[model samples]
Target: MSPGKTASLQLPSFLHGTYRSVQQKVKREGLRCAEQYRKEGAFPSPRQLLEVPLGEVVVVQGVVDIQHERPVWRLYMVSEVLRDVWEALDWEDSSSVRDAYEASFLETAWGALFFTLARMGAVSAERTARRLEAVLRFWDPLECARYLFKKPGAAQTLEELMVDSCGWAMDAWSPELEGPVRARLESAAKRMERATREDCLEAILRQMPRALAAGHDLKHRQVLADPAFQRERLTMLDTPSFERVSGACTSELLEKLYDWDHELGLQ
Candidate 1:
């Protein structure tokens, strides 16, 4: 509803929240900071970034404090930020991505920005598709899983990824995940499914003591280890939400990862 944001294209559910998040951020701070850009002439409306050319829109780095920085947005060129996101956000593999969920909200939001504009038809179809491919190249089950849980904790950004990854942003598009990437995602899902079973076993094993205190051990809970969690590959959930794991439910991704009925692990 901010001025110049009157583009009638209804943002898809997958992207609406992030679009709002960025809008809120602009209203809160960018509005004040953007005045500098206004004087430069030809600056696109900062309030409605979707109005900017896909190649032109730029976002602040997650590590930046816009309040302190004179320039609210990064000095990085649109080309650089776009390339840096995928290149820097890269993990060893799905297992690598699943292990720590290393990509940060500030980082992944770039992907969401592009994804939203694409889904909303804010940009041309060909360009959106091409841009999304690079961003999503870094996405996986763990990537999508980032948003599967409640956004209240440290996962607000992750929830945003879930919108892009699982909320039909990828699935409902004209050209679904195709060619090498689709194969790559399937392979990643397979690995994560097996790994999660192992993850669950360890998590459940660590919960044996609590079950005993309750005078029963019949049902073991899924739990993460202390920061000292020694799995080497993964550790317990940290900070805002320790009780939950990022990719736990993602084990259920595509409903094809695990043989839940017969192979609940524990062997």
Candidate 2:
């Protein structure tokens, strides 16, 4: 296909400009090499044609774009797309293709790093706390357990995933707030671990209020100490909109959070 037509057909706008430029360069170079081989009365293999250093082109273009932009969400979306592309490319046996996939994967990691750093600078501790509470508010231990158990030879239980998720939330906060949050999460994990399989979800749900209460206390203390860290008031979407005591609310919110397919239930 012509370069312009190929670009329009194969590349999304998010990956246009530099990405298209590099792709066109690689395509031209590869075609030139193939034409030379064809004139020599020997057709080159597909692998030989793809032997051009496409990985370097992709990496250079991606790095330049990353440095020029500061949108974390865009970076995240690009990273996810790159990851999918990398996986899709894995079926190819060529070393050059493998190297290009690796380069794409590295770019994905860079995107994630940029996103984390951006969020660290832009998001406030209070906002982080509220987001954490929102996640825990919809924490469904039954679904977690079911998913984990369904996985063959699962290393960590539902409690571990919950605890680890909570720990990740601590990363968005100041060091002072970590102690209380970690303690509460650990305590919750231990409590859930001790529960019977049938009652595990109930045990986890029961801890939600206490976790939120502790989070609020710690958040208040952090805000009092560093008023600058206090976030502006949140909109309805930023915070959970249901009473803590409502199980039905928690179920609905969890369904939304996990993006459960209505036809398949929680997959």
Output the number of the lDDT-best candidate: 1
Model 2 segments more than 4 A misplaced: 1-68, 71-82, 85-179, 193-195, 204-267
For residues 1-267, write the lDDT of model 2, one tens digit per residue: 113321111112243234445344445434543354336523232231121111111221132344333321122233333233334445344435433333332222222222322222112233223333433333331112111212223424324533443443332122134344435543433333343422323332333333333443232333322212211111122323322111112222233222212322422
After superposition, which runs of candidate 1 have C-alpha atoms over 4 Å from their true positions?
Answer: 1-28, 41-118, 121-124, 137-145, 148-267
Worst 10 residues of 2 by lDDT: 48-57
Against the reference, the lDDT scores of all candidates come to 0.31, 0.30
RMSD value for candidate 2 = 20.2
Best-fitting candidate, scored by TM-score: 1
**Steric clash pairs (candidate 1):** 147-159
TM-scores across all candidates? 0.24, 0.22
lDDT of 1 by residue, 1-267 (tens): 124443221111222224334344434333332333235422222233322221221332333223332322322122232233224334224333222121221134343343433232122223333434434444432132222122222333423543434332232231234555444434333333344435443533343233234432222223222223224323332422222222222212112112221233554
